[model samples]
Target: MNRTLHRVGAMCAAHPWRTLTAWIIALVAAVVLGGAVGGTPRDDYDVPGTASQAGTELLRERFPGLSGTEARVVVHNPAGGQLDPALLDRVVDALRAVDQVGVAGPAQPSADGDTAIIDVRYTVPVTDLGADAMDQVRAATGAARDAGLQVEYAGQVPEGEPTEGGLGELVGVLVALVILIIAFGSVLAAGLPIVAALVGLGIGSSGILLLAAVTQVSTTSPSAAAMVGLGVGIDYALLLVTRHVEGLRAGLAPQAAAARATATAGRSVLVAGATVLLSLLGLILSGLAAYRTYGFATAIVVATAVAAAVTLVPALCAVCGRRIVRRGRLDVTEPQRPPLTARWAARVGRRPAVWAVLALAVLLLLGAPALTMRTWPQDAGSQPTENTVRRAYDLIAAEFGPGAYAPLVVAVDLAKVPQDSVPALQDRIAAVPGVATVSEPLLSPDATAAVLTVQLEFSPQDERSGELVDQLRAETLPAGAEITGVTAVFVDIADLLAERLWLVVGVVVGLSLLLLTVVFRSILVPVKAALVNLLSVAAAYGVLTMVFQWGWGGQLLGVDHPVPVSTWVPLLLFAVLFGLSMDYEVFLLSRIREEWLATGDPFQSVVRGLAATARTITAAALIMVVVFAGFMTNADIVTKMIGVGLATAVALDATIVRMVLVPASMMLFGRANWWLPGWLDRLLPHLGRRGSAELDDPADAAPATEETASLEPAASR
Candidate 1:
């Protein structure tokens, strides 16, 4: 792997412009081809084998209109009077005339007579609606607005607006650039990684767009993919660039330095990328089409990032050559003092048990909240107050009861249950403990199926709403009746994820253990890494629970009140964080293992490895945390949940696990940290990096320790 990467890096570096041109060509081709043939991302909420899914499928076959999208035009007379009936008729006529609309209802008026709801149904599913669906709805309601009526929209039709992001992502990139400059103290070095990351991101983003052409990619997938891609892309490039700088300081020629850096750091990059992709494979095991699309989209971006780190970064480094090095530092001949990180490592190593115990305590405390974590699918009620959909949700909750905002649809197969028994079924459902009201059954045109809308006493976001759904499925409804709607579908999705969450975690953890063991040639190290990463992930989940569920600081992130954590967050976070946290682990452990091979003293190896890679790891982690946190600015609660969860996990992993626990634990374990059973070692293929041989000079090595028991006292060092 090292030799092959070395040759590729050298070739690219030796012909810099050619390499740049090739990347540019690839980017352009991807964009042009994607624009011509790429598919758009559409959310696939279908969860097979679930009752909600079955009901939805049944409706699509027998009563297609009810299965499609729906919208509610909420109108209110702010002047404290009943609305004009003629004006209401005009509004209904306007909506019914809109393209794609299957039906516009007789407006349902509030008891106070001040507010009314016009329910509109589209002839197609939400995903099938065109880009102008919302615009068309808005245009139809303009006349009502013009006549001094307060109007708002809610439900699936209004939910399709493209979420506002991009700005936060752009801000994150700019911040990353600044951090890189400060870390490297060279503008050229700082710019190289950014450039490489951008090139790769271009291709990755284009690829995601193209992917939409073939599969059902969720609307959220692109943003999620970009967030992961950008952070990892910059981090991967940073790793390679840092190593190239080390090569230059060691007096290697520009092309040789680039080649050697690629041979070593590039190998870690590959392994890290593979781990991320492998972790994403667990998402495929989730058995949800939406999650599978998310996994594929994110994997594509990560793959491109790895490619650019190995190919484009080295070429750019070679092109810049010695200029990447700070001028005065290159010619240093005096004995260099230990950096602050090395001093810290030595201190921790001196009292391994103390530091390890303290770090574990802190992590456990932070993770405790996860024990009470609750999850539900986000809905319009969770939206910020400033949004029209949120206003619609609030208005409906205020005037017509909160339950009316998300009424459950009970689909009945008329063939199994006679039409004469339909009235009895409705009365049976309405008698259930939580049922608020039940609408008269509406039969399909063919009279083969019928649907009854059931309102609950509690709002759709309430836990009782979900419990009620469970009650209806288990006891209340007849055999021919299946409950499905926005609320019911969400409940079903949550249940599906709960069942599959363990499957995903097991796959990711088990596969990651295997991969890391092979890469580091150590069983304990991989096991330790997994354990620590789980702590970080749990801590993140705990934080999310506090902020979003407990409403500890929900207002700060545009969350007006406490709400359940998004259903998909825990599963997604586990898959993503396990891989991402392992990125730092791989870089740190790879360096430590390289030093162990060179010095054959585990104590010094830990100290020297900490010193060598600490700064790079810190910078990379900061970039990732900042990038992930930036997404908190988005209005979408699900997006905010993901951003906060990822940022928290990365930050905790970098500081608690990497800085304190890992070194202390390594010191406690001593030589056992790298030990592998002879049989297992023989069974594993040689996949570890070239290690110490990649360095051009022994002068680059950290100062040797005299005692192998632990680092010398900070004073003596």
Candidate 2:
């Protein structure tokens, strides 16, 4: 063992209670401070500073009071053709009474007649719409319904909120607890990881809130951040505790076992945490404010999990060492011929190349479906189900003219154009394809800009909506000018995101590959890791396409049929699932590497690593799968996509990649598995020695004496 590890191990043996108490105090303080801080939900679009952002900004600036780029509420009743006069008056009164609404009116029906649309706007900045705002909308909708008029509210605000209530978060924690219980078969043992995870989540969330107080972090960031923290936090504790138990089974004194576990398992966790944090940080390359907030918040939570795993977890283990060891009579005796792990290690030493190729082939086959993946544009009430809001929207389209959601606002700077050209520009836009109706240009109060509301023949969420946007940008708008509106803003935002898609993918894949290479110290290993991870992600995307896009099992999944996939969900899921899958890969490979290093045998190493770690990995994966599946119960389309995508990835990664492909390929690889070249080997730094050691001299290797040594406090790396 290294001098630093041994020193820390000794300290853990001496004063376990003191160590545990300090960690408890720190965690409590963090939680208390966190509660005082609150964060904002992030907007999904990339607002301007770039060309796309500038385009979006121009649209918003030109439109002024036009629905602010988000979906707006247009309530009416079709049962009586025109709303009943009394109901119309009541609806108008209700609309005017809505707090924070910028513009409200019981507007006259179109030239065809028989429909009345109330244009209700928000008083606060449209970007401020969040959980609180959604709640207010829900309340207002209910009130409108009570007034004897049908009501429908659809926008980004309502769609973003998780529809499964709090079940997703609750299920995540519960599933983790159940897995830990089965893994350890002890209440205290199982409970410890959950406690650690809770503390980590509390601290991470509080930190985000505090950070948001100083800067802008989106509201959605917190929920996603919390999920990431809980998973990684519990997984880290599981690794540490499992190691400690193994040490005890090796006949070491309780304190000694705990200390050894802290030194070794704790170090691996710190490395893994750093890698996850870095991968999350890659989101900054997205160049979108919303994505940036997600990156920063998720990175902070990952850091917190690392701290809790290394310091808090070890401290607790130290304090409860004897009790934990004595509570269950776990077998720890060392076996003849090193150990089963070592024996299996010897088999892998026989062949390594064949195993590598088989794994690669399987991964490629699974990843094939990603090539055909498509993106869905943002639209009001487009959450894959035909809810009341969507039904109301459809009725409006049918009764009134189409484009009832919101018109594409084109802003013309009349001051910059010749007086004769003003009429011509208006005529040009009115003639554009899909422009069913055009309102006379309303000059801004300043008179510098003229706003023209052009209602299209298609719904705002329809593919034609995007086509209309493109047509305006390409054909309607003349040179040296701008056009802006809800459809235009969304189209521009989508373009910006699409442009940066490759960069985001590159950053995530590049950083992950770099980290894996550093950890494994081999060129081929990192490449293999990246391939397998991508394959798993591709397979998940395929399942999402089948379930969400094709509407297969939509009813069972609590979603409506044939809903387009959310534009942002796939990107978000890619980043999230990539990090998570890498985490599992790292854990499994670290064990395999440990055994391979000891025996210099690839086949034996594969068997030992799988046999020793498979049960734990499977248990952990199931916990995550259950948590993700719980999100499927949400009525929201976006949440459902996230849930199903994540759950499928976890299942496939755990069962196919980890159990089948990884082992089969390793069995084929032999000694070339660890054959890093001399120069590259020299450049890569070795982290530390593996924890378990066989007794070369029985007496010397026998369990340490009753005089327990204590672990030194962990220093931040």
Best by lDDT: 1
lDDT string for model 1 (382-501, tens) is: 888878889999989999898999899999999888999999989988899889999999999999999899999889989999999998899888787899888999998998899999
Model 2 spans with C-alpha error above 4 angstroms: 1-32, 42-46, 49-52, 59-71, 78-81, 84-101, 106-115, 122-124, 128-144, 156-168, 322-329, 332-366, 384-395, 689-717
Cα error of candidate 2 at position 708, Å = 13
In terms of lDDT, model 1 sits at 0.87
Q: Give all candidates' CA lDDT scores.
A: 0.87, 0.66
Scanning candidate 1 in windows of ten residues, the lowest lDDT window is 705-714
TM-score per candidate, in order?
Answer: 0.95, 0.86
lDDT of 2 by residue, 1-717 (tens): 233544464465466567667766766786677666564554555466633445345445654564342434554544555545565565566656655665566555543444556666554444565546656655655644675556665554444443333476687677778778878877677777777777777778778877776666654677677667777888887887777777665555655666666666666676677667766776787667777888889888888887777656666666666556444345333344455434443443344445445655665665565566566654544654455456656657776656856676666665576545767777887888788877887765556666667788887767788887777777767653565555666666566667777787788888877777767776776676677777888888878877766777877776655666666676777788888887788788888887887887676667787777777787878877876777666555666677788888888888778766666565655566566789977886775555345212233232444322222111200
Q: What total of clashing residue pairs does each candidate reach?
A: 2, 44
